[model samples]
Target: MTAALDVKGLTTRFETRAGHVTAVNDVSFAVQPGRIMGLVGESGSGKSVTGFSILGLIDAPGEVTAGAVLVDGVDLRQLSTEDLRKMRGRKVAMVFQDPMMTLNPVLRVGDQMTMAVRVHQPMSKSDALQHARKALEVVGIPSPAERLKAYPHQLSGGMRQRVAIAMALLHSPSVIIADEATTALDVSIQGQILAEVRELADETGAAIVWITHDLAVVSSLADDICVMYAGRIVERGTAEQVIGGPRHPYTQGLLDSIPARHEPGRKLPQIPGSTPQLSRLPEGCPFQPRCPRATDLCRTEPPLDVRDGQAVLCHHPLEGV
Candidate 1:
């Protein structure tokens, strides 16, 4: 079966004053309908850039130089700007980290959502409003009819985010790229949203790419996990495989370093050093400088070693599974 969203060898770069910085290099992944693929990594790992690149949201200095971002077998990179713009909301939707990115402070929540679908389809205002109300209800928003008339600022943070998600669902798009959308919410609210989002995908049959730095969240919310380092995917496998037995050193470090993994009175283990700057990344593996498994072979780039369907970019992959 064809994937709902397929990204192949996606390379996005920015020309900075220092030099060219590749934010996403030859990254590849596929997400089928009703499936959620977690793009997990630290800040500046290029996960957010990957999401923006997929939606044609990259700005002037940043550009997607190579590879394809396909939505239901249609390559978005091959489309014209106007065509891409048209595809964004109807065929693909993005739930940005900040609710304000999706909500216009000046516009009433109802009006904004109504405009979202109306632009994609020639629907009457009343029909659009009805559609918006139904979407809000679908996302578990209460008193949807009254919520629509209020401005974004009138709603609480969680409410605003729910409104944003409801807007994304308004079009029933084939794909949704949620770039750290729940990171800012309180823990309880975040969990509520995550559960709701998973249910939403199941109900709508839409593929979702959830980009986040929180592994604990992904371990529970995602079916598959792609651990990114310095713009490249260093590990990819089923969520349980990656979380239970991480082959890549970077993946291991991430799991080991999370606070929840530490026992009482024990400090959370931290990965040595920090993520490398994209412009000055080492010639070999980007994580080699910080990897404990580095060797002479690591000075050169490591091929993605495939074992039992799991892939790890490391000269010496970890053992035990």
Candidate 2:
């Protein structure tokens, strides 16, 4: 079967006062149906920008300069505005970090959900309403019928996010890009939302791109993981492979920084230096300035290589199995 989503040589750039700034540089990955791909990185690492570009949501001075975002073999970049707009919510949807981005404070929850369903599907108001209610039930919302009459402001943060997720699932889109969708919620709530998302993907065979800075979250939810640094994906592999035995120095630093994984009484390891601004990015490896294992060769750009099913871009990758 065709991959649910495939992104090839994806590059997003912005025309800023300082000149062209690349936010997503040649990032590529694929998510199979019923699978979740986790995009992990630090702030300014361009993980979120990659997702936005794939959804054709990049605006203003920023645009996807090169790449093919294929949803079930149909290239999204090649579609016209009208066609892309139609395809967006029907074949692919995005769950944003903030639920307010998806919900209208002035509208009732039922209206927002049903409207989304009707916009993508040919159905009567009654049918759409029924679908909306069922979606709410599917996402574990309590009193689904009563909640539909409430406005977004009336619901708690977690509830609003659940409603937003329900809206995304309204049409059963084949692909969903979740950009830090659970970051703002409490731990329990975040887990609940993830479980719901996982269930939805399994039930509908929808491919999901889960973008976040939390390695722990990715470790639990993703079948595969991609680690980004300074706009480029520095490492990609199965969740177990990347999380258990990261090859790139940056990836190792990330794994070390996790508080829970640190040895008792030991200070958590942090990758030194901040992420370089896009306008002033270093000449060679962006992570070289902070990498503990950096050498003279690391000062030159390293090619991304595939070894043992893991893709790594580093001059001196970790040796041994």
Candidate 3:
């Protein structure tokens, strides 16, 4: 089967008055149908930029300067504006972190969802609304029929996000890019959404790119994970492999820094130093400043090393299985 999404050598950069900032550098990953791939990273780690670049949504000073975002083997960058617009909701959809980004404050939920359907298919309002209601059901929303008449502000945050997710699923797009769509929700709500999303992807055979900074969430919700640091993926592997036996120092640091990993009273481990400014990144690994195992060899950028179904980018990765 063709991959649902394939991003190859993606490099997104921003040209600012100060200097050029590489937001996503040489990132490559593929999500097969029915799989969830977590794009995990810290703030300014370029995970979100990767999402925007894949959707051809970057604008103005920022651009996808390299690589291809392929949907079922077709490059999105090659599509014309009209074609791209048509392909967006029909082939690939984005679930933004903010539900408001997807919702129209003035529009009724039913109207917004029905419009999403009609935008890609010629369907009557009644038929489209049926689909919308079913979508809400799929996302576990209760009182779906009555809620359809409500406006965005009438619902709680979790309800609004579910509506956004329902809208994304209304088209059964081959791929969905969820950029921290559940981060703002409480832990229970976030877990519910994550579980529902993973189940939906499996049941519908839709690939999902779940971008967030929470390694714990990804560990439980994703099949595979790519750890990003300073605009580049420092590690990639099966969720269990990466989380349980992380090879790259940065990945290990991320795992260690999780609050749950430490004893209740002990200090939580954290990567030292703030995220570096992309425009002024050192000549070596972006995580070198905070990496405990950095060596002189790290002064030069390390190539992504692929071994035994894992990719590690570091001069001195952890050894011993």
Candidate 4:
């Protein structure tokens, strides 16, 4: 099947006083229609940068140096700024971590959504409002009509997030990039949103790029997983393959740190050393300094080892038990 979203050799860099820092390095992945691809990593792992790069949202000081962001076989990088802006909400959309980033605090939910609808489509205000109500309903928001009349601050965090998501779906975009969309909500609310997202994917045939640091979230919600470290993808596989049997040391360390994976009351295992500064990354594998399994071979660039459908960029990948 053709990918709804395909990213190839995505590289983004930042120009700092010290030097140029590569925030996203040769990252590549594809999400087929109705599938969710989890881009899981640590805070500075460039997963978020990848999301912004895909949407052409990278600003000054940080720029997407190379790559092709293809949505429905159209390369977004080839489009002009105006064209890209038009494509953003119509063919592809993004839900930011903070709902406020997408919502206007002063505007009523219905008014904002109506404006969003009319931005790309020439529609009457009443008709646009109807579309907004339907979108809210699609995200499982109750009393959609009433909720639309309320201001953003009047709703709870989860409700605000759902509204943001609903707004993203107003155009029926083929690709949706969600950057930590549910991180602020409580677990129960997060679970509820995840369920709704899964349903949205199935019903709308939209490919979702779920960017998060939480393996647990994606373990249940994603069809595929990509583990990133130091702006590079370290592993890629089906959710089952990556979570059940992580091959890369970095991936293993992340799973091991999850509380549920350990016995009660025991201290969790952690990958030693924090993420290296982008400008100061080591000569070869960036994770080598923290990897217990590292050897002389790890000091140089590691090979991409593929077994079954799982791929790990490591000289010594962990064997499945």
Candidate 5:
């Protein structure tokens, strides 16, 4: 089956005054229609950069140097700016970590939402407003009509996120990238938003890429999981395989760090050492410094090997079923 989104050998780099820094290195993944894939990693892990690269949103000093981003078989890099702009809001949408990134504080909520719909769609003002109102309602906002009239500042954080989501759904895009979209909301509100997003995917058959640092959130929402470290994906598989039977040391470290997985009195286990600076990455495995399983062979880069359905990049992957 054709994928809704297919990314192959993607590498993004930033040209800083210090030097060129590789942010996303040879990353590849696929998201099928109506399915949710979680891109999980810590801060500076290039997870967000990969999402931005797929959307062609990387700014100056940073660019997609290699690889193809195919949306429904069309290579996005081959499209012109005008074509990309048109494709973006209509075929693909991204929900950013900050609601402000989507919401304009000066603009009234109704106008913002309606404008999003009207941009890609040719509809009368009244019709667009109707569509926007319905979208707000779909995202579980109460009194959608009243909420539309209020400015973004008037709504709470959760409400603002809902509005952003409603805007993303305005055009019924085929793929949605949520970059830490629910990170700022309270647990209850986050759950509500996630549920709404899941329902929307099921109803519309939209593929969803949820990028987040929270493993627990991914475990709950994603059908598949990709674990990244230092711009590279070290482990990827079905959620059950990645989360239940993690093989890479980095993946194991993440699972061990989760408080709920530890004994009540024991301290949470953290991966030793910090993420290496991009320009000064280690000679072999990026995780070698912190991995207890690292051996002499680990000093040489390991290929991503497929075992069963899991893809793990580790010279000394934990041995077991």
Candidate 6:
């Protein structure tokens, strides 16, 4: 089956006083309809940059240097600016980390949502509002009609987020890029939203790319997983394979750091050292400086190793347990 979204060899760079720093280095992944792919990594690992690059949102000082972003087999990279803007909400939509980033402090929920719907589709205000109300209902918001009349500040954080998500659904986008959409909510509310997101994918047949640093969240929510280090995906596989049997040392370290995987009283383990500075990354493998399995062979660039539908970019990958 053709992927709903396919990203190939994506590379994004920022021109700084020092030099060009590659923020997203040859990253690639695909998501099929009704499936959720978790793009997991530490901050500065390029997960968020990858999301923005896919949507053609990279600006000034930063440019998408290479790659093809295909939505429904059409290369988004080739579209004119006006055409790309048209495709953003109709074919793909992004839910930002902060609901406020997508909401207007001065506008009522209904007003913003109806505006969003009418942007891509010419329709009567009432018709657009009906679409907005249904979207809120789809995301499990109660009293959708009443809530639409309320201002953003009038609602709780979770409710505001639900409104933001509802707006993303106004167009029934084929692909949704959610950048830490649930990180701000309390655990219970986050769980509720994750469950609703799963249902939304199944019901709407929308491919979702969930970008987050929290492995615990993705372990429960994602069908597939991509573990990133620096700007590259070091490992890609089903959630079972990546979370349950991580091959790359960075991935293994991330899994080990999850507190739930350890005893309650014991201290949590952590990946040693921090994410590398993009411009000053090591000569070869970016993770080599922090990787325990690194050897002289690792000083040279590692080739992509594929086995049993799992791929790893490591000279000495851990054995599948």
lDDT of each: 0.90, 0.90, 0.90, 0.92, 0.90, 0.91
Taking all chains together, each candidate's TM-score versus the true structure is: 0.97, 0.97, 0.97, 0.97, 0.97, 0.97
Model 3 bad stretches (over 4 Å): 301-304
Ten contiguous residues minimizing lDDT sum, candidate 1: 301-310
Model 3 residue pairs with clashes:
none
| Deviation in Å, model 2, residue 97 alpha carbon | 0.8
Residue-level lDDT tens digits of model 3 in 1-321: 788899999999899998898899999999999999999998999999999999999998998899998999889999998999998998999999899999999999999999999999998999999999999999999989999999999999999999999999989999999999999999888878988998898899999999998887898899999999889888888898898899998888778887787889898887888889988887777777777888777768664465557888877878624
Q: How many residue pairs collide in each prediction?
A: 0, 0, 0, 0, 0, 0
Candidate 5 lDDT, tens digit per residue, 1-321? 899999999999999977999999999889999999999999989999999999999999898999999898989989999999998978889999999999999999989887888788888988999999999999999999999899999999999999999999888888999999999999999999989988988888889999999999999899989999999988888898888889888999989988888789898888888988888888788889888988877777654465456888888786423
lDDT for 227 in candidate 5 is: 94
List, residue by residue over 1-321, the lDDT tens digit for candidate 6. 999999999999999988999999888889999999999988899999999999999998999999999999999999999999999989999999899999999999999999999999999999998999999999999999999999999999999888988888888899999999999999999999999999999989999999999999999999999998888999999999998899999899988887778989998887778888888988778889888888877778764455457888888888854
Write down the worst ten-residue block by lDDT for model 2.
300-309
Best candidate, lDDT-wise?
A: 4
Q: Residues 30-86, candidate 4, lDDT per residue (tens digit)?
A: 899999999999889999999999999999999999999999999999999999999
Question: Considering only N, C-alpha and C atoms within 3 Å, which residue pairs clash in candidate 6?
Answer: none
Model 6 residue runs over 4 Å out of place are 302-308
Which residue pairs overlap in candidate 5's backbone?
none
Q: What is the lDDT of residue 31 in candidate 3?
A: 95
Report model 3's TM-score to 2 decimal places. Answer: 0.97
- Candidate 6 residue-wise lDDT at 7: 97
Candidate 3 residue 125 Cα shift, in angstroms, is 1.2
